[model samples]
Target: MSPSIEKNNNNNSSIARESITEQVTINEKLNLCFPLESLTQVRSDLINYSKINDKKLDQGLLSQLMIDDNLLCRYMKRRRGHIEPSVQFIIGALEWRHSLGLDKCSEETFPVELFSSGGLFILGHDNTGNTVLHIRVSHFYKIPELIGLVKQFVMFHMYKADEMGSRSFPLTGGWVLVFDCSNASLAQGDPEMLAFINSSLKNYFPAGQKYILIINLNWVLRAIKTLAFTWYPSAVKNRIKFISIKQVTDYIPLNELPDYLGGSVNCYRSIPKNCTTLETLRSNGSITLAQSAYDKIIKILTLVN
Candidate 1:
């Protein structure tokens, strides 16, 4: 009708269009989508791990900004070794100054969620052989189920061998964390999912204690892990240090991996103090920020006493 009225109508129309765009997942433009809570947990754990190693990386103010991005799910060719991409995610998670609003951002989609939350990450691999990844959210309950559901989707779709998780590799005598790869899709649970996992474990793996969910971060963008330091007991806390993979790989005289994870391994507080790679892996469960100490724990798997 009038000039002001026409402008108002145009503004409303624009808002409506933007809302629809958010819902649509076009082929080339999908923001990093991950279950909110899971991502937070993993990120928090890694930050703790980093502190123990104490190497130090570039940190920014908006490092903890809550935003849904597909940064981790998709694979970038340039990423090599564990440390490089891990560091990249930390830096990229900082405040995006240019404000491209995700979909338009030129950077490859990154799933910072894989750090802690489980979700489907679309990693477009080259026309080579298949890659495998298996993720297990051990304390899948008490938090939320959406994290598991999303991860199931990403693993199934992208990696042929990737799965929700089943029996943590081969633990001695313990209830296995069951994984149903057959049902390779998101299955929402009311309250029953958590109940079922506990119930089933009690029946099948009653002896299983301290579940070591053997997850594969095969093509993961940022591997976030959350550990409860409170559960670590003081005896385990003081001996944290970085050891080399070469150090422990050869020390095995056990019948079968000494329970799949060695007990002699140590967890360090910082990466800077790493004398070898083994120590780096053991203590790197959390490493985004080198903070004092939070609710995270590094359960280093060692061979012998």
Candidate 2:
């Protein structure tokens, strides 16, 4: 289907559940509608081929990252003395995504986070049984300053590798990068970051490029806030998309996600439906999966135009 039709249909499909749409949940909706049969098959196949000790894909990747990436090895080793708690988890997640393509218990990145419902949900209960963390570390500092922090954090060890040993590290070549903003937003869209990001969106993100943007999600709020009423809106329309990482639990049927983008018509209908999604789905879990798929598939039954 054409992008416009897909967007329109996707937007109109979720009329019943717009009352509380969060980022990851919106992501789930998009994924659910995209191609589940294929995605599930790929997911299962990946797990079967991988999964050491029955560990999740992300976990396995972390292990591989330590052994295979030299720059990363030095980075980790350097931090041996530092031993920061936040870095431990962040490094673990980044390593996993860098090496293996897997989602988390709550929802991790392809290469970023874990699987699940609301990250900050009450006890964080995802249908898939993953606990997600909804954190937004902000540094209302300059973009260059933040970027420098990231580079220093990652490349610091990269530079130290020479003193540590060139042959003993796996990170001689840094890991590839892939950046997706589908689940991102900024507080105040900073023009500097926005411009750079949009430019990358246009000419940089080649078919298989892997990018790493090490920033707290909350930074997105700040980054986005700056761009909300900026001059780039028209120039960068649809070039990039961001989803908030907060709405994981508010899930219903994928078929019901599109209506969310309907602006007002669907918005009006969404209020009441969202209020009752829990009860509705709770009573009908038996059929929601199939029904959601069918509703979306039926839309393209003819595949005309």
Candidate 3:
């Protein structure tokens, strides 16, 4: 063939080889070799769908969408590889996090009572390496008026759990939630908060919940919960298990659990006491206050085996 024709054929061959190599690399890395939709196609579809929907993500979110293969895989798997729904779900999560200033939330943003009460805290990890989120439901009623703060507080833990778990189990990182319902009453079940949590599990944090343990739930609450289970997807509903304190050890090693749950972990020590808001610490050039919060998190996370 002529010189120009040969050059064109060589360029085409190079392009074809690069394409096949990229596909193999993605499959090996993600371990997701979907027959119909590849990761590349899903990512391209996400960008195009975002534009079509008039959803303009900020640079950080855009980067996550494009570069975080694990994140994209989670959303894609959640939606069963449906490109449009996956894009919409992730965009919604990103926008919601940005709107709530989720990253900015810390122990200092709310009263010490919230953290001190031990209503919600990251205890340790499960037997399978998932982060454990402990919630003493009764304590939630103490600060009824602080529901807004509580919402942010809960999301902060979730975001932090995802961040922490991703480090250890990058592809399949998730959290195990334990709701201690011993002294909790129906009145403490704020409709708004419950709805927020339900929606969060279904939409915001896609495929990020490995298990949900409900300890000490009375029959009445169990019946009520059975009715509520109808609203959840089977994938989510199936992960929830009702168990007593003793059975908790089946999922989480006894040593990783807190004393209240018949384990050796002393979670109370990790609670940051009298720490100033991170914002205030940043403004005043006070590293000690910030370090306290950082240390608290480090201590809490390290407690998990």
- TM-score of every candidate: 0.19, 0.21, 0.73
Q: Write the per-residue lDDT of candidate 2 for residues 205-278, one digit (tens) a residue.
A: 11211122222245546545455437455534443233442342232122222222221222211111112222
Which of candidates 1 and 3 is the stronger one according to TM-score? Answer: 3
Better by lDDT, candidate 3 or 1: 3
Where is model 3 more than 4 Å wrong at Cα?
A: 1-22, 29-59, 142-144, 272-305
For model 1, the stretches where C-alpha displacement exceeds 4 angstroms are: 1-7, 15-23, 27-31, 34-305
Q: Candidate 2 has what TM-score?
A: 0.21
Give the distance in Å from residue 197's predicted Cα in candidate 3 to where it truly belongs.
Answer: 0.7
RMSD of each: 20.6, 26.0, 8.8
The Cα local distance difference test for each model comes to 0.29, 0.31, 0.69
Per-model tally of clashing residue pairs:
53, 57, 0
Residue 54 displacement in candidate 2 (angstroms): 10
Clashing pairs in 3: none
